[model samples]
Target: MANTKEIQNRIKSIKDTQKITNAMYMISSSKLKKARTDLENTEPYFYTLQVALARMLRHVPEMEHLYFDSREGIKEEDRRRGYLVITADKGMAGAYNHNVIKIAEQELAAHPNSELYVVGQVGRHYFAKKGVPIDIHFQYTAQNPSLHRARVIADKMLENYENGDIDEVYIIYTNMKSSVVVEPQMIQLLPMKRTDFAGVPADVFHEEITMEPSPKAVLDRIVPNCVMGYIYGALVESFCSEQNSRMMAMDSATKSAKEMLDDLNIKYNRARQAAITQEITEIAGGARAQRDRS
Candidate 1:
């Protein structure tokens, strides 16, 4: 029903939007590939860390250390908890940020004494506007996951745990199961259980292995490195999920824009045809009037 010019303008606007969406999709694909490559490159180191931890635990099955302490003496309701929540720095991704924020809210509701340590700008801004107290000193961007950044975060978390600031530490992040499937997940980071390493096969050796200073001392050094590896893995996984979600969202947008363009083209053709028919009718009427007057 609208004029051809207006429809043409609308078509142009949609075409521009489609270009932007297509560009975003391609960018997200690149990011996702890079993230996966980083993760793959770092996998062996973390796997080795896990194996070392398992071996150490096998050597001293009855050892009691700060890292393995479950803090059973502390009351559940009174114990302070820290949650490291990973979200997106920016969001055009459909429900990626929303899902993470929802899970974080649920966690906070369950644990009223928990402190929120958010990694993304989106999450930080949302929590701030809602008056939810976020750790002011724990500032970090969620754009790119790096080993150095993960190490810094891990050290801070371990320091707080050592200082009795937080009784428990947990990481909330998204895991990309596949290109199209992603789910938000939470895992305990501190006070690790021995059973967690049960699945990892302990090195089999006939000789009795003896640690240099003490098993506890060696474990103390290895545990922090292992913790850093875990944090790094979580960061990488979350980053990949964000990229995957963004890719899907942008792809959908581009397709929808194409559909709109198709429909609009049909309408434009109809409008143009209708205008030409009207002009022909008007010309015929004028000629008929002239003939009648003569």
Candidate 2:
């Protein structure tokens, strides 16, 4: 059993920690709200891009480009796969980071020879410990997610894919739905395929607009932009999900701390009362014995 002073100090320390956790919870909640709104806005743009790209594919049926064609018959010497694993820069978000790492490990289980790209500190650490071969580690100083940062990451993946360092690029991130719901998602980012652009809008589906250079030239430019847009969307989703997870985890911690404080306070009061009663009883006995002797 700890002495009164020791117990009191411990309680004080826990109270201070509880205060910090509560503040963090509030901060996470506020950020989650803003992130949620941003993610919602991006959804429409993603759909629009998908529709536009689908339209382009429909209008150009005879497009004999790698972006629209299959390379199944190509030799194994011609292809390499790249996996981009995105996670939170910090932890304290329950299993949020763990789930992403686990899914990525599972997905890459069969591809030991594939190149790995990591986007966050958590994922980088996990894969590094697992002996995963990382070809690139993207670093960002932003405390929050930025579209520009995401575009840079997109460019890195695109450049590698186009330069033949990677045959296919895949993005792994946590998809945000709500504060309580975050799902891990794995999406292919490269080898720009026509089938990947299946959701284009009907109106823009077949507009035969002339390009300034040529169809191949237009696609070459648009493909990178498309990759950038997709990566930006994924980063937004992953950040939002991280905020939500942190908020939820901190909420639970705050609640648990409150309960523990309540229990400890009750125990301290009971111990103090017991000690006082014992002192009073001893004094009463001493007084009675003295009176009898008198």
TM per candidate comes to 0.97, 0.91
lDDT of 2 by residue, 1-294 (tens): 555666688789889989988999889878877876876777776666666666666777677776554467756655677888889889998898999888778867766558888888888888888787778888862246666787788888878776767778888888886657999989887777776566444553334666668778877777777787788778878887888888888888989888888978877887788888999999999999999999
Candidate 1: TM-score? 0.97
Q: Which candidate is the best by TM-score?
A: 1
Q: Write the per-residue lDDT of candidate 1 for residues 119-191, one digit (tens) a residue.
A: 9889999999999999843456578789899989999999999998999999999999988899999999998
Q: Which stretches of candidate 2 lie over 4 Å from their true place?
A: 40-46, 75-79, 203-208
- Scanning candidate 2 in windows of ten residues, the lowest lDDT window is 199-208
